[model samples]
Target: MAKRRKKRKFILRRVIVVACLLVVGFFFAIKVLDLFGEGNSKSEESVKEESVTKEGFIEKIAPYAQELGQAYGVKPSIILSQAILESDFGQSKLAKKYKNLFGVKAYGNAPKVSLDTKEFVDEKWITIKGEFRVYATWNESMDDHTKLFVEGVDWNPELYKEVFTSKDYKEAAKAVQDAGYATDPDYAEKLIHVIEQYHLDKYDS
Candidate 1:
């Protein structure tokens, strides 16, 4: 009888030990699953943040700029930087309402809207209401912008020819300014700053 009691007691102890191990393993597995879920949540949040930020604006325009750059021999960085500055990330009234991202002026009965614009003149800035071209889409505006470099102004067909022949983005920015693309004295510097700030030149190749 004593042996029988001893055997039963040993079996009970073994059963208890096995149960405890199982409980510990179950808790550990749950902890690992929780950690994995949290990691995925963090990754998803990062992606969402990227989509809503200024970098998002750059990404949206980069593909089009790269395509235009290849077709026109223009630097994508220069085009992107100009769009950002001129369109205010597509937030300007001209960009939002008219899809005119470059502040391009209309001439000879082309589609246009009169809007207030600021121009640097005589070592100062002045606000002038001017007629700007209207476009059906951002792509149209970007195409027209490229054509300005390729076709140049009415007075000089080669006015912006230097912009197309430049070796680098910095040179292109300077060339645009030298060719009088904008009246701002710091137009070239602003373009260079924006290009470096966002690593815009990565799309140049």
Candidate 2:
């Protein structure tokens, strides 16, 4: 009976050791997974941050901008510069995820992307959750931008007529500002800077 008891005690000890090992292994596995997940997340963020810049953006979207600008009589340089300012060189969430480059407000039967955005309202900047328009492709977004000018919605029709008829990028930018395209008050100056800095006017020709 004593021998049997000793045998049972030994088995119990073995079982306890095995259980402890499995517990340690499970915690270790979780730690490893967490490390891997964090590494992948950081790398993804870094890639996103480096994905687009003015130089790269100008080359990538200039063709589409030119085509759309030509179709609508809008200066491609001004269009592209406005696009850069509105969409942050197409790196914004609305641009990357929804392919919306112009930051048009959501309306009609179109789908939407709800995001917090800053707007100058009543002479003050306010952050509000806004439903931004979404498009299936970048071309569609450009097309929509052109349409917004051709046929204004509830906001304002022919809002940028002066911009549309402008002879040059600077004039176009000034017209957009005069039309209240942005509340920055220096919207035209900034756009002119962008147009000249990247030589976006070359696309107009």
Candidate 3:
């Protein structure tokens, strides 16, 4: 009888240990799930913050772009889109330090900085060192960008005339591409995509 009692106690201890282990495992799973939920929430919040910052940058430049557009007959959407693309939303080292938003090259005695740039050449992309213009402020950079469309370049006095006289943003983007404003083959497409994605055409009104 005593042996049977001891056997019963041993089985009971085993049952209790198993129950405790199950409880601990259940709690651990819940803790892991909570941590994952928190991580997702934080990630979503970070995306939201990044979006807000981008929108803020756009708003900051909109006024100047619009004013320039009105004065020069250039599309505000084109100006804003180029700025966003060239400067990477005003975060590029060139834009931040030198204030050259359009990647405008320096000529003659103008202040400039030499930077590594990529150009599409002979159906392939290649890295090249080029000199870019330096500006005192973003406004100056924007003004010069407007002037490029208004006054054109030294080689072709009417190079960018179509860009300013375009009836819509799409035409202007195509004009810019045709005028060889950028070496990228998809330059016009990129401008159109950005203008549509951000609703930049609203500024043209």
* Predictions: Cα RMSD each: 9.0, 8.0, 1.8
* Poorest stretch of ten by lDDT in candidate 1: 48-57
Question: lDDT scores for all predictions?
Answer: 0.93, 0.85, 0.95
How far is 126's C-alpha from truth in model 2 (Å)? 1.5
Residue-level error in angstroms, candidate 2, position 95: 0.7
In model 1, the number of clashes is 0
What lDDT does candidate 3 reach at residue 64?
92
- Which residue runs does candidate 2 get wrong by more than 4 Å? 1-53, 154-156
Cα misplacement distance, residue 23 of candidate 3 (Å): 2.1
lDDT of 2 by residue, 1-205 (tens): 9999999999999999999999999999999999999999999988876654556877888898888877878888877887898898888989999999988888768799899988888888899898999899988988888787777656677777887778788888899888876678778999999888777888989
- Candidate 3 deviation (Cα RMSD): 1.8
Ranking by TM-score: 3, 1, 2
TM-score of each: 0.75, 0.70, 0.91
List the candidate 3 regions with Cα displacement exceeding 4 Å: none
lDDT of 1 by residue, 19-51 (tens): 999999999999999999999999999888865
